[model samples]
Target: MSAIIRTENLTYTYSPDTPFEKTAVNDVCLEVEDGELVGIIGHTGSGKSTLIQHLNGLIRPTSGRVIIDGQDIWEKGVNLRDIRFKVGIVFQYPEYQIFEETVFKDIAYGPKNMGLDEKQVGERVRETAALIGLDSALLEKSPFELSGGQKRRVAIAGVMAMRPKVLILDEPTAGLDPGGREQVLEEIREYHRRSGSTVLLVSHSMEDVARFATKILVMNHGSVFCYDTPPNVFMRADEIAEMGLSVPQITRVFSLLRKKGIDIRGDVYTVDFALKTINEYIASKGSAREDGHD
Candidate 1:
């Protein structure tokens, strides 16, 4: 399938043509395929956010082009508002954006703007709220009256109501408890599965990304550091550490085990994989012990 999003030599400058000018993204090129779940990761000030903004026409590239579904999003006469509908972005702490008196109104805002029929907007609002785990009864209540986690879910439902083809989330679970975080992440995964949309998750947690993303993009100092599957990316533990990043905890544990002379693979990123490998090792050692006695 063709790329849902593609960047060619994408660059962005902050305070351009001024004394305080700085390049936030430099000579970057990448492609995000249709229905792919991708994660963008970086330390602070690595331009991850800036890069994502270009994808949905939120920020026009200072140089080069951003193509969404074979069309240059910045092209003349192209309606950016339409692009936004196609590429939904949920900002960090999206809950803060909620201003409507009721959760239903907040979630319906996007579809309403699209001129959808009232019935369609209501249907979308209810469906999206359910997808994000928002209670049906809460739809009529003021959004500000809800808990922080609940507000976050409402905000996410707001975007999902639009049914965008590409969904981009910037730290969807920031500042939530473990349970809240898991809930939000699970909702996002379920949305992707049901909609078959392209997903771009920007997060700092390697473990979370490893669990959800099919591909990982590591950014450092306004450039692409690496892009690969989680296992392949985490395999370079030393390099990742040098870049002020880290592999998942399970991967790190396996790496430490390898250093201690364990005869097992060190590249395991998921807990399930790590546990399976450990069990196999134990079974093999047990067989060896029996054979030695025989």
Candidate 2:
């Protein structure tokens, strides 16, 4: 598939030319293919937020280019509004952005703004609400009355209603209980599977990313530290850890076993892979003991 989102030497600085000037994203370049689910992870203040904002033309880069669908988003005659519609962003704590009285209206907001007729907007809202697992019974109730998780789901549904070709979610599962987190992540994964939209998910949890992301993008100090498939990226566990990021728990477990002189592979990154490795090790040991006895 072609690259749906690409950035070239993208740089953004706050308060340029002032003592407070600081580069939030510095000379970063990356590409996201059509329908690919990418996980972006980094320490706080590592420019993960800054970089995504550029993709949708929400923020102008101090230098460099952000190309969406083979077009430079910032180029003259380009409609930034159109870019925003193509790339939907559900930011961190998106629940705070919900202002409509009812969940239906809140989710309808984006579709409404796109000039969809009443019937079309209603259809879009209901379809997205269902996709996000929001109950139809809650559609007319005030969003504020809903629990925090439900509020967040409503917020996500709003973006989904827009039918963006590329969906970017920043910290979608943050500030949720474990079950709630899992629910939201599953909803997102399902949405991606059903919609075939290129998705960018910013997350802090290595386990969560490892479980779902087709690829991982690691950032450090406003620069791209690493970008690769989950297994390949996690294989550089030591390099990632040095960048102030943690590897998945399963990867760390295998690494610990290897360090303690166990004959095990340290490259395992997922629980399923770890279990398979353990079984293989056991099988090999059993075969060795049988041969020795013979």
Candidate 3:
């Protein structure tokens, strides 16, 4: 897998040279492989948002470079709009950005902006609506008339309609009910699997990341804390706790169980993983007991 997105010494400062001057992101370097589902996590004010803004040239880097598909996005004479089309970003609570009268047109907005024909735009609108679990009937209603969860899905569909090479979402499941959250997260996972597009999910939910992400990028104080697979990153529970962040609850439980000499896997995060680990451990225990009795 080649690197589709790379940042070299990326840095961004807010209100530079002023009394309120602050460095939001600092000298961060990273590489996201093509077709990877990467999760970004950090505490508030840890520069998660600032770091992503630089990916598609939403925010010009104060220093360093952002390279996408082997081209520097900040290169002079580069078309920013084209870059945006290739890297779509859905901000947190993206529903607020929806203004079109009907859901169909709202979802079609991005495809239309790309100068796609009506047929192409309509196809993308319908396809993406389905991908995000929006029914065809909802496309006829006003975006504002839908429920909060529906509106969020519409906003997400709008971006997905573009079929960008890379999709970035910031806290996409925020403020949704438990069922809505699960539905949205599962839909996103399916979308990534079906589209084979690079997906960067900025989330605070360790469980979500643990279940879906192939890689995890942890940030702290505007710098890359670590970028590793879910198992490896969650293994450093102590360090994550020190940064005011936490691993999945199941991960913490298993870690404690390991500390107690339970001889169980400490890296389990999701419920499924924990259950499998426990079942295997129990089976092994029973087998050992039977052998001792023999």
Candidate 4:
């Protein structure tokens, strides 16, 4: 399958030629396949935010290229507005981006910008709102009047209304209670399931990524550290820790178990996988003992 998004030697520098000049992203090359749920994790200042902004043309690279559908997004005459429509991004605290008075208008912002008519825009708004569990009645109320979680839903619905082919979310679950976080993450998961769109989820939580992401991308010091399946990435737990990141909690538990001479896989990143591995190990041990007794 072809890549939906590809970045080649992409680098971005801030305040170039000045004392404040700094490279936020450096020679980062990566590919995200169509219909993938990719999780991006990194330490602070690792360029996760800067890298993602390039995907949607929110920021241009000082060097290198961001290619979408095999076309260079920054090529002369490329319609950047159209590119933004195809690649929707919800930044950290996306709620701050909300400016429309009513929830309906806020959610309709993207569709309207796409030049859809009232009927199409309203339909898209309602559909996306429903997808994010927003009530139709709440659509008429001001977004500021909603609860924190509701505000997040409205913000997410705003992006989903545009129905982008590639949806990028940055820290979608930050500053929320466990219930709120789970709700938002689950809605994102369901959105991916139903839309079949490529998703880039930039999060700090290894457990969340381990549970949802099809693949994990680790960034360190403005470069691509590792891009692989969760299990493969977690297998480098020591390296990840050295870089100031970590694998999931259960993965650490299993790793500890292995150190204690238990015959268990240390690479399990989720509780469910850990349980399955442990149960299988116990069953094998039980069978061996039974055979010896026989």
Clashes by residue pair, model 4: none
Off by over 4 Å in 2: 289-294
Structural similarity to truth (TM-score) of each candidate: 0.95, 0.96, 0.95, 0.96
* Per-residue C-alpha lDDT of model 1 across residues 1-294, encoded as one tens digit per residue: 999999999999999889999899999999889999998999989999999989889898899999999999888999999999999999999998999999999999999999999999999999888888888999999999999999999998999999999999999989999999998899999999999999999998888888989999999999998888877888787688788886788888888888899888766888899999999999999999999999
Top-scoring candidate (lDDT): 3
In order of listing, the candidates' clash counts read 0, 0, 0, 0
Candidate 3 structure quality by residue, lDDT tens digits, 1-294: 789999999999999989999999999999999999999999889999999889889899999999999999989999999999999999999999999999999999999999999999999999999989999999999999999999999999999999999999999999999999999999999999999999999998887788999999999999999999988888887689778887888888888887888887666778988899899999999999999999
lDDT of 3 at 164: 98
lDDT of 2 by residue, 1-294 (tens): 799999999999999889999999999989999999999999999999999999999999999999999999988999898898999999999999999988999999999888899999999998889889998999999999999999999999999999999999999999999999999999999999999999999988888888899999999999998899988887788788777788887888887787799888777888888999999999999999999999
Model 4: per-residue Cα lDDT over 88-148, one tens digit each: 9999999999899999999999999999999999899999988999989999999999999
TM-score of 3: 0.95
What is the lDDT of every predicted structure here? 0.91, 0.92, 0.93, 0.92
Against the true structure, candidate 3 has what lDDT? 0.93
Off by over 4 Å in 3: 283-294
